[model samples]
Target: MKLVLSQEQRELRAAVRAFLGAASPLPKVREGYDPEVYARLSGELGLSGLIVAEEYGGAGAGFAELAVVLEETGAALLPGPFLATTFAAIALAEVPDKELLTAIAEGRIAATLAQPSIDLIADEVAGESATVTGTLAQVLSGMEADVLVSPALTGDGVIMVAVELAGEGVTRTALETLDLTRGQARVELAGARARVLGPRTEGGVGDRLAVALAAEQLGVMRAALDAIVAYAKVRVTFGRYIGSYQGVKHKLADMHCKLEQAESIVRYAAWAADESPGELPEAAALAQAYVGRACFEVARDHLLLHGGIGYTWEHDAHLFYKRAKTDEVLLGPPRVHRARLAESLGL
Candidate 1:
C-alpha cells in the first residue's frame, strides 16, 4: 500500500494547519466550545463534510483525508463538537438516511455516540421505541451534540439508534476534564425517544473510531516532539545549548523515533479503513495499541523536557499532556487494544 501522501492531501493538511494556527490558538481553545468557530470550520473549511459523499453536500474525502484534518485539530487542541460530529457522520454514512447525512454535511446539526454500556439493552422498551438509561461517562462533545447516535440491546439484537438530545428524558451535564479543549459530558437518557438505524456489528464503528483517534494521537505526538525539540535548540545551559547535551539529545531522538512510528501506524490504519475494510479491525487495533501509549510517552517527555515552564497552566505543554492522557483511555487503554490485536493475530 502507498505510504506517502498525495499532493492534494498535503495541500489540504497545510490549509487546515494554517486555519487552526490562527483561529484555534491555545487561549481560544481554552475558552471552550464556540459555535461560531465550529461554523467556520464547517462552512469556511468544509471540515464537517470532509468524509461525507459529494451528493450529500460533503467533500467526498476518504479516511486518509479525514485523518489529515483530525491531526490538525488535535495539534491545535480545538474545542468543539468536531470529533463527535465526525464520528456520527462516519457511523451514519453506513445507514440509508440521506437527510441526516445532508444535515451533518451542511453543518446544520451536531451529533455524537453515547457510550454503550455492558448491558447493551435499552433501559426501557416499547413498540418501536427504546429508552436509553444510564449515565454515559466522558462523552466527547456530548453536551453540545444535537443528536446522539447510541446503541440499544433489543429482543432482536443490538441495534444502533439515533436519539435527539433536545427531546424529553435526556439530560446532558458538562463534566470537567483534564483537557479542556476536548469537552466531555455525562449524558443521562431516561426513556429517550429514538429511531433505529440498523443492527450493530462487533467492530464496525469501533474500528473506524479507533483509526480516527489514532490520527489525532499522531498529531499530538508530533506537536509535542516538535515543541520540545525547538525548546532544546534555543535554551542555553552552562554556555551550551541544552540540545547539545547527550541526555537531552537522546531523549529528543527517542521522541522523534516514536513519533515516526506512530505516524506510520496511524496512516496505515487510515488507509486500511478505506482500501481494505477487512483489514481495518486489526489495523486499527494495532494502531491504538502502539500509538496510544507512545503518544502519551512523547507528551510526558515533552513536559519533562520543558522543565518548570511546562508545568504551568499558561504554557501549552500541559495541554498536550492532558490530551494525550485522556486520549490514551478515551477508546480503551493501550492494553485493551493490545488484547484485541493479539486476538486478531490468533495468539
Candidate 2:
C-alpha cells in the first residue's frame, strides 16, 4: 500500500543523513576509510549493534530501520562495509542459535555474507555444522569480519550459514578491485567450521537483502544522475551549457525516468519488507531486476555524459559504476532475479 515514510521514519532519515554528512562525507570515500575506523565511527553513532536487542546493547529497531540506514548510506556514497555487516546482522538476528546472536549483539563479533561467485549446494550440512568449501570472492567486510554468512546445502535445502572467518580451516586473501575505495576480500574457506543459521532462506534472507540492495542501487542512481545533471548545467560547451544540447537533454530525460522508477520499486520493496515478507518474493525479484539494471545503465550514462573527464579516478562516477556492478552480482545476478521473477509468476 502506502509506501510513504511516517514522521518517525523521516526524522530517522534526517538524523542519519546529518550524522553521515559530517562523519562520512565525500572525502572519506575518496580517502578510503578503514573498516576498523568506520566501524568504530558506527559504534560512536550507535549503529554498530543497531539491530541487536536493547538488552544486548543495540537499538533493537528491526529491518525497517536498517533499510533507512542503508538508503542514507548509499546516498552519501560513504565508503564503509556497514551495508554488508548490517545485512549479515539481520540474518544473524533471525538465527535461533543464541550463541551466534549473542556474539553479534555484543559487537565483539563481526560477520559478513561470504556468498561467493561460485554456487553451493545442500548435502554438505549433515554434521555438527554446515560446511562451505569454495573461495568466496569479493566478500564485503571480510578483512574485519569474524564470521561470514554463506549459502550451504542443508537438510532443509539451501540455507544460509555463518562460518567463522577465523575458523581453523579458513584463509583470506584481499583482492584489488576497480572500486579500491571499498573493501572486498577473497576467502579460501576449505571445510570451514560453521553453524547453519537458518533454513536455506534463499527466497527470504537472500531475496530480502536483494530488495534492500535495490534500494541502495536506487540511491546510487540518484547520486550518479545528480552528478551528471549538475555537471551539465555548469560545464558549458561552445559558450552554451551542454545540458542545453538536444542529445544531452534527451539522455538526461531518459536517465531521470529510470531513476524515478527505480526509486519507486525500492520504496515498494522496503514497504513489503516491513509489512509483508512472504508476499514480496516476486516484488523483491522485480525490484532487483529493474533497479540493478537501471543503476548500471544510469552510471554508464553518467560516464558518457561527463565525456573524457569521467574516466579519471578523481571523478566519482566510476565508483558508482563499480558499486552497481558489484551489487548486481551480490545477491544474485540480474538474470537470476529475472528468472525468479518469471518463475514466481509461472511465466
Candidate 3:
C-alpha cells in the first residue's frame, strides 16, 4: 500500500515542528519535564487527544495522525509524559470509559502502561480488584501519571486494569536516566486497587505501542541525519569540507537510505493500525525491527560525524545518542521485534 502524507497531514507536521522548535529547545529539554509545555501541547495543540474519538472530547484522528505528531515531538526532543499518556489513551479507548477518556483528552490526568521487567502478569487478583506487587524498573513518566493501565494474570486469562497511581500501596520514584528529556521512574505497586478493563488478547495494545515507538524512532533518525548533513556541509578539515570526502559522503548516504526505509515502514505500520487490524502485528514488528536499529545507527553516526564536539555533553548530539539507545530497549529492542516478525511470518 502506498503511504503518503496528505496536504492536511503535512500542515499538521509543519505546525507541530514549528511549535516544538520554539517551545522545546535543546536546553529546555535537558531541564527535564515541563508542565507548562505539556499543558500547551495537550490543551492548545490537542496532541494528547489526536487519536481519541470525537465523542471522548478528542480530535478523533487515527494512528497515522498520531504518528505525525510523535515524529515531530521526537525530532524536537520534547519531553514529559506524552508517550505514556498516548499509550494509556489507546488502551482506554478500547474500553467504555467516558470519564477517563475525557480527562485524558483534556489533559487533566496522565496515565501510562505499567509493564514490569520482573513479570508481565500482576502479582495477585481477587474479584474485580488486582494487587500489583513488584518493582517496575522503567516506567515512562510514572512519577507524574495519575493512573496506570497494567496487565494482570487472572483466573480466566491475562486482563488489562486501570489503577490510580495515587492510591495506597503505590510508590513512584523518579530515576536519573541517560536521556533526561524523557523522564523515567521506578514504580512499586503493593496490593494496588485496579479496575478491570478487559481481556489482554494477543496482538493488542502492545502492537499499537510498537508502531507508535517506531514512528518516534523515525523522527529521531531523521533529525539526527539532518543535523549531521547540515554540519557536514559547513564543517571543514584540511582546507576542505568533510562532506566532500567520499567516506563521509557515503556514510551520510547510507544514513539517508536507512531513514527513508524507516519512514516507509513506520508509515505502513501506522496505517495498518488504523485500517487493517489483521496486518498490525506483522507491520508493527517489522517497523520496530528495522526502525529501532536504524535510528540507533543514524544517531551514532551523527555523533561520530560531529567529531569531538559530538562526544561532549554540551553538544545536542549526545542527547540524541542517549535517546536512541534508551528507545532501542524501551519496548523489547530490535532483536525482540525481529523475532516477533519471524514468528508472525512462520519462518
**RMSD after CA superposition, every candidate:** 1.8, 3.2, 2.0
> What would the TM-score be for candidate 3 when compared with the true structure?
0.94
lDDT by residue for model 3 (193-218), tens:
77777766555678899988888888
Model 1, residue 158: what's the lDDT? Answer: 79
Mind giving the per-residue lDDT tens digits that candidate 2 earns over 213-325? Answer: 88778778887899999999999889999999999999999999998888778777877776887768888899988998989999899998999899997877788888878
Q: lDDT ranking from best to worst?
A: 1, 3, 2
Candidate 1, pairs of clashing residues? none
Off by over 4 Å in 1: 116-131
- Residue lDDT tens for model 1, 99-180: 7788888888998876645333574555556776655766788888998887777776777788888899888898988887
**Candidate structures ordered by TM-score, highest first:** 1, 3, 2
Query: Which residue runs of candidate 2 sit more than 4 Å off their true CA positions?
Result: 53-57, 102-107, 116-134, 151-161, 190-203
TM-score for all predictions? 0.95, 0.86, 0.94
Query: How accurate locally is residue 134 in candidate 1, as Cα lDDT from 0 to 100?
Result: 54
